[model samples]
Target: MLPDEPRSSADPSPEGGPPGCFRHPGTATGISCTRCERPICPECMVPAAVGFQCPECVSRGHAGSRRATTRFGGGLAGDGGLVTRVLVGVNVVVWLLAAYVLTPQLGQTWSLFSAGRDVLGGPAGIADGPDQWYRLLTATFLHVEWWHIGLNMVVLLWLGPPLEEALGRLRFLALYLVAALGGSTFAFLVAGNLMNSVGASGAIFGLIGATIVLQLHNRGPLAPVMAFLVFNLVVTFSRPGVDWRAHLGGLVLGTLTAAGLMYAPREHRGPVQALVVAGALAVEAALLLIGMSLYGA
Candidate 1:
């Protein structure tokens, strides 16, 4: 009689295929890929060169497998942070509240409350009043409509998790917050006359920017990501009602932000991270300067 699979109950008969061993009689021999957690059957189970890996593991290896010249972090895959998820949750909640809580009258009244505006001029954004600047952050959590909220949440959720995993949670959160501010600041400068826009697209685009930088810095499975970014940018340009400027502004700021973070040497201790953070802020300040100049002129 053929030996049973390591985790399989059924034994392979003579006419059947190769012999297998069983570590568990009740369970099947199928195993999960060590890398991606996909299941792999016997025929496909190449002798674990390094060791036996299931299909998922095999595929992950393929996706992340770097060429000889690739840099570090090139073979990483999977979500490793919670910041993106929390942001997504908050955005979704705000959207639901916007839709369900607003009575016709309340909707009209609240529209002005949540809508973003230029604080320096025009209607002044929601938080333009004393101690209201917090709205700068809150407004990011707000969305104007179903489609607006839905699309943003989808992108935020999809991209946020993976990117956060790549960068630590705190760093990822910082990235999102900074990106949001960068986008808003850019909007404030570019929409100089009188314009108001609010959404999480800025922060979402920031994640995309980080992904792009990551691809450039360390080559790996970036084709899918690049494709996604290109498609979104195209849609932003092609479609009506899309704020491509804020998107692009966020993209540029985010790219720089990611680059700043990546280049800042982490070798130094306590003071080094602080220094890096400061440097990133200074870079952002410069960007804001550019925006202000553009607007002033």
Candidate 2:
């Protein structure tokens, strides 16, 4: 090349015609990075407030690029809460235990069986049976079928992040656990003595219900949430071997729980949330007693 002509696009232009890209010698670049003043091709350009930047300058802008957090310190993606993650982890761990260890060695005691529902009258049985009372809580975490757990987890993952961020960790966890209990209790109330069930559907449904209530309270769109609930309920009733009773129980309980949270006096929200949790436990107890009475009768 002559002295007046640029050797390559990567080299600086002669007589200010256009500078060659630093990285690609053959590509001519007219613009220089505001920070580095280096000639860069279109591919390397990173948009900035003042002007475009080269890759090196853009890479060091981590501090500037971070968006402000919410009141709860959540990130731009609403990812500060860990309660949802912990709930998922617990469910997965318990599922693994049930599938690999408990089911084989301990049998179906971990699952919710109608046998657990006890009565003081003619239904002379164990409210004290081997792990019977505990099954309501434990069954929520136990899923023998691969697809059962997979579908439940996918739904939880999709719904958990935003709800957890909105409600904070403790309240979110309370709602989920309570919903699980409610579902299992409902199942116990209706199922035959020989019937058994296990899965996280109750908890997943609870999250769905909670999300709908929360969005409604915030004056956000409601149609989508209602549609989701309606679709899932329809599927629950139509699908063979699916526990619609548990899903309905969970949805109702979750909706109540979220409503309690949203309506409480702002200064006393924590106490109200705790009270709602207590009420859920009370409802579970009441349902179990009713179920026991029916079984005994």
Which candidate has the highest lDDT of all? 2
- What are the runs in model 2 whose C-alpha is more than 4 Å off? 1-79, 116-131
lDDT of each: 0.62, 0.75
Where's the lowest-lDDT run of ten residues in candidate 2? Answer: 117-126
**Model 1: per-residue Cα lDDT over 1-297, one tens digit each:** 345634333454345543332333333454544544444456546556564675555676789864431122222334454666777788877777767875343233333132223344423433244243354456667776888888887888777766676666666777788888777656655563344556888878888888878777676688888898999899999998777767887787777777766655545422554565566567556654554444332
Alpha-carbon TM-score of each model against the true structure = 0.60, 0.67
lDDT of 2 at 257: 85
Error of 2 at 283 (Å): 1.3
lDDT for position 47 in model 2? 90
- Looking at model 2, residue 230 earns an lDDT score of 90
